[model samples]
Target: MKPSYPLMLTALFGLFALTGCGVVAPGLAAAPPTPVPKTHHSAAKQKPRTPSPVTVPRPTSGNELGVVPILEYHMIGPTEGRWQRTPQGLYQDLTWLYDHGFALVTMQQYESGDMNLPAGKHPAVLTFDDGDYSQFEWNSAHVPLPTSAVGVLEAFQKAHPDFPVTATFYLNNHPFGVDSVAKMQWLVAHGFELGNHTYTHADMSSLDASGIEKEIGEEQAYIEQSVPGYVPVSFALPYGGLPQDPTDRTAVLNGSYQGISWHFLGVALVGANPAPSPYSKTFSVSIPRIQVVDPSLVASSTRYYILSGYEAQFLQDPSMLYTSDGSPKWISFPQNLSAQLNPAYSSRANPEQ
Candidate 1:
């Protein structure tokens, strides 16, 4: 059953008791709405572009087998409600995460085992799904609105340079309510990753094999065409619905549509829990994500409060959270957890005493 939006807001208000933690009262002022540009669906195809290689720093001291919080978000608007976070709330979320020794990493980085961070720092993946206009909007002057999600992230990074600006935006057709190819290019060029979220946000559980291919493939083709060589490597299941049939499910991991084949390294789910480290034996292509919603706003059956839930658990037992070993070449962890390391990464494992 879906949670009530109004009730969720009321619960958040009561949870924070109107604290100045960016939870504004209803009807708070926001930037005036700007005219949305028409999106382009160009049929022209171009060769796939490769992203520049990045250097991973030396390994720091921490458990590489710990869990990573792949935070999932939907709407970013003025009012905080079900599956929605306000601009202020978004800022506050980053503040809380930064203060808690968390740094931002892209979904690709997490999946490829390239997450290198400072000693004692942990990695967190910020994912925004169903790209709504509120998540990203450009003003008449061609600048991201201060209240937009991207704007908020840029601002936070500028203020806290140590907390790098990186995230994965899982987009559907007409992403962020705009079909402009330039917008898509802008995201990729700015170091943000664009992940496939299906073409129509279809419920895969009800769709057959062909339907799944079309949904996933069309979106991939669109992104690749839009960005001219940029292929999405990560996928987020729409509605968190996976194909019921085992074979159909496998198609999502690797499939082709109209000859435009795709291979996803990580498939994100809507589960409200931290994801296992990439180097863990338990790790697989299917990754779990914790919804960044307030626990009070959700029903008891759907408790996914980031602060009071998983974050609290990490605070209590830091070992449970994936702390970077600083170097990308070595997967380091306590010797006790040696058994948890995936054999594929055994050559790079550095189990310490």
Candidate 2:
């Protein structure tokens, strides 16, 4: 069996302390409480079995924890410069997902006032980080392969218009140039969401609160300035990282950006990731992320993305939810509304057994 993460952390801390003191301390024998099992989710009843369903706990409040996919992406293009993905590869990936049981959703669909998810299911949000100009060209250019992420997204949108599909681009102020801002504005006008990526892609955590705000908010202000009324509310931490706890690290221009996208916002990294996304789950401090490594990885991994949402909850729920057979151990919540988790959102890492 895999050792618990808390235990490992404790052991590591103990070792560090021991190294300093050169002896075991008194009253250090006691261990912390085991995390409560996420009850609301599981593939089977209590018993030994494979760890299939991600141990994401069901949200205590259904309305706060809406079921949906927030798919993250970066440079989706042919250039193999680490972040780019090919157009043909991207299309194949999307086509497979659409053909399967999945439906691409918009952040708007996730808001409780708009639409509710069915029981045991939630809509997925598609996101792009770095604001690469390549995204817009997908529509205009007719390159041999789909040429860009935007091109395939348009293809998917056309194929499934009412599927509630929309993409959020976390615009980077410095690296990527402007010609696409107008196109970005246009996308937002058509129900697509726009979000902030940071003016210079600097580390928000490294700065003081004011400095952080300026770092995050300035770019947002710039985007709005470039394209009248262009505000990208949602936030994607630069370098896929975020600020400290309870830190309000957002810059809402057109709309409020309370929601966050996980790091690098990649395609393969989005397996139905339950909340407390694999990146961070501290609620306040955790800036979620999905690594957009490349096209091959994206093409191979869809089930992981779909299941990630359910699993994210499973990992957080203290109930230790599981099934008798343990196939689809998801913590069920009322559709449409998102719920809060119990025991507080943990900032430290917790390992699953």
Please name the candidate that would achieve the greatest TM-score relative to the true structure. 1
Q: Relative to the true structure, how large is the alpha-carbon lDDT of every model?
A: 0.76, 0.43
Candidate 1: residue 190 Cα off by (Å): 0.7
For residues 1-353, write the lDDT of model 2, one tens digit per residue. 11134423432343234334533222211112123234545645557667686555533332223323445555655554334556775665566456533445443333211333343233345677676666665223433124656667766677777555566676667423445656665676766766666677665446555666566556666776666865443555554333443233322111222232222112111112333321111222222233333434333433233323334443475232211111122333333212233233233212222
- For residue 8, model 2's alpha carbon misses the true position, in angstroms, by 25
Worst 10 residues of 1 by lDDT: 27-36
Over 4 Å off, model 2 = 1-67, 79-82, 108-121, 138-145, 174-178, 244-272, 276-287, 292-353
TM-score on alpha carbons, each prediction: 0.82, 0.53
lDDT of 1 by residue, 1-353 (tens): 12245434533443343222422212211112111123545623555567666455435368999999988778887887677888898898899889998988999888877776877878999998877778888877657888889999988988998888888999888876664577788888899999999988777878988999999999999999899989998998776566777667767877998989998878787655677788887677777677777666776644534545776677789889988776757788988999998787787777884
Model 2 TM-score (2 dp): 0.53
At residue 46, candidate 1 shows an lDDT of 52
Stretches off by above 4 angstroms in model 1 are 1-60, 304-307
For model 2, the run of ten residues with the poorest summed lDDT = 263-272
lDDT score at residue 185, model 1, on the 0-100 scale? 87
